[model samples]
Target: MIDNSLGEQYLRIYDELNFDNQASRRVGFCTLENYYATVMEHVGTEVLNTGIDIFGENLAEQWTVTKQILETVDREPPSEFEGILQEVKKHRGNLYHNFREDIPQRRLDAIRDVAEEWRAWLIDCAREYWDTFGAYTLEDFDYIANEINDYSQAYMGDIALKLPTIKRELDYAFRTIAKQRHRRLHYLETPDIFLYDLMPNKTSSEISKISTTYGKIGMMASKIKKGEEIDTDEGEDLMYDARNILISICEQEDPFGRTFNNLHSSE
Candidate 1:
């Protein structure tokens, strides 16, 4: 019943995402530009890596990488994904070259929604790819659970030195807050979680934690808006009330939790 935001869970075969698209550290509850960058950074990198793995290092560009992933997986992406990719490119162009300061909130939210859907599809395709080639996917003795094993294993020797740091990073990822599907399931299982509604001050610490988590998410957005890599924590919780609260907001508004993003907006 763990939330998907725990990035370590995906350490076995693929790296789809640790959290849902909107509340993830990648998007950081920020603006559309950050959301767009996050989608491209995660999805684009994965697709590009798949291409370089399957088709070798001559991968052309970001859009080409997405197409290559679709072809490699032998799964046709939905037609809407193509248009979404175009928007992704447009966002990237606007984010980088043109650098506009003015964009409509509705448009940004819409783009965030589109990017989330597109990334979800990409994750599905990646899962299919991993499932398909997982058996014969090793190169000699280079197999590692989640990492690509087709290449050389020269770095394996460093494992002795890096294991502690890796564990620390994972611990951080597990505690960071975000959107997750499992939040609803867990909430449904334990109605007592609603007791906090009856006695709000009883769980003041919990409320503070959620607020802090949300603040971290927003910080991530600001960092991404400035084109910084996602650097933050993934806070763990006993009941995952934080994630559920955000998901609830998304349900009332739209799929990508734009309500929370627009909470501070004048619009």
Candidate 2:
């Protein structure tokens, strides 16, 4: 699979471009330009490193990775990709150097279309390389597994501690219904648990309170694992005390705007 980072960057570019304001559109264009440069640089660096490793040859410098690869590497990108690269360069240059405050929406849309082509070609090139040569070593798997184990405990522990009673009751109910029907059947709805709600003026139920406390505890544990400092005087009791204070405040039924203004004013 292509790295999630690349997908995330693409999503950011898409989201910013869709904003209703010109400033946001400009920012989207800037982000798209930077990401385009970064991916090209990464592809060039990979080709250069691989060439040095396999063929022990130095490649000449070029304005872009696409050009460098054509000159140095044995492989060639699709003929049409070069044309798309030129289109990408034109947009990148205009966005970078043009002093005009407002870029036409139609021009931005044109660049976006070209950018999609550029990105698709780059991803295909990357995928071809990875398919030709495997992407990782056994050591890499060990490292990834160890990292997952370290963080997963904080999450899985929260679920295990809070959901056993509910899960057991649901299981019993489902089994009873299955026995009546003389066939094994799954629950009608999948179980999903949320840890926190961020909206203002929303009061938490009992389970929500527990989930919030668990979220804090998990956060503290993560910080400790990362060797960051936490409030030591309260020890492990900090989450409980914080939850109680939040509950007390919520019970007051105070106006959210006044409460927010007062809190910030005091700060």
Candidate 3:
């Protein structure tokens, strides 16, 4: 869990600033300082809790939690992770120590973005660490840890790119469910057509393309289910084409057919 004590402090400062109005410009500054402090504390705590192995003579040195986390995962810290942590720290410093009359919205936005990236990285690192060396030795651990870190980094990067689309797709799904409920109550019949035709048995590349295609289909389905008429002239054609492809693929005999047939016959 996240430590909320500092957040509470920042909230209290904000409340004070709001109450005093003109007299509390200084209070607003103070609130900004408190907020930065809180954010730093939260980030620090998260880094520590990830349970990274920090070995070497400098272990006793006051290394940042982010450094520790990366070190634990790869033995050698990643430059990318280090860079993100530095950016977060820089923003925190600016929010705390910089006594400018007006806080730039851009600075705050940058800080928020950095925080989000930090959180995503930490989560990915935790998963990679756990999955790789939940039970392995130093040599085995090193190899697996490196591989898992590389995989996790790539995976996180890809997921980050798709976050906006993922959110849209999920929102569409919820809306579609609500609409479907309404339709069931009124029409008392479910739609027979599948909005997206996907073949789980297909090759990885095909599956990935279908996943992306179907995600859009899912969003479209949500609109259709809601009784909000969507122009699916293009969507309909794609769906029809996809279904035909899936049907053709499914009808093909299994590659291990003869061996399985003989085994079954023997049994």
Candidate 1 whole-model C-alpha lDDT, 0 to 1 = 0.38
lDDT string for model 3 (178-218, tens) is 23222122111221122222122456665455445556555
Off by over 4 Å in 2: 1-7, 18-22, 47-63, 70-81, 114-117, 127-267
* TM-score per model over all chains: 0.33, 0.35, 0.28
Q: Is candidate 1 or candidate 3 better by TM-score?
A: 1
Check candidate 3 and list the clashing pairs. Answer: 53-72
The 0-to-1 C-alpha lDDT of every candidate, in the order given, reads 0.38, 0.43, 0.40
Over 35-97, each residue of candidate 2 has an lDDT whose tens digit, in order, gives 555555555444323223211221112224455444432456555655545655665566557
Per lDDT, what order, best first? 2, 3, 1
The TM-score, computed over Cα atoms with residue i paired to residue i, of candidate 1 is: 0.33
Positional deviation of 169 in candidate 1, in angstroms? 33
Show where candidate 1 strays beyond 4 Å.
Answer: 1-48, 51-60, 99-101, 135-267
Task: Please tell me which predicted candidate would have the highest lDDT against the true structure.
Answer: 2
For candidate 1, the 10 contiguous residues with the lowest summed lDDT are: 173-182
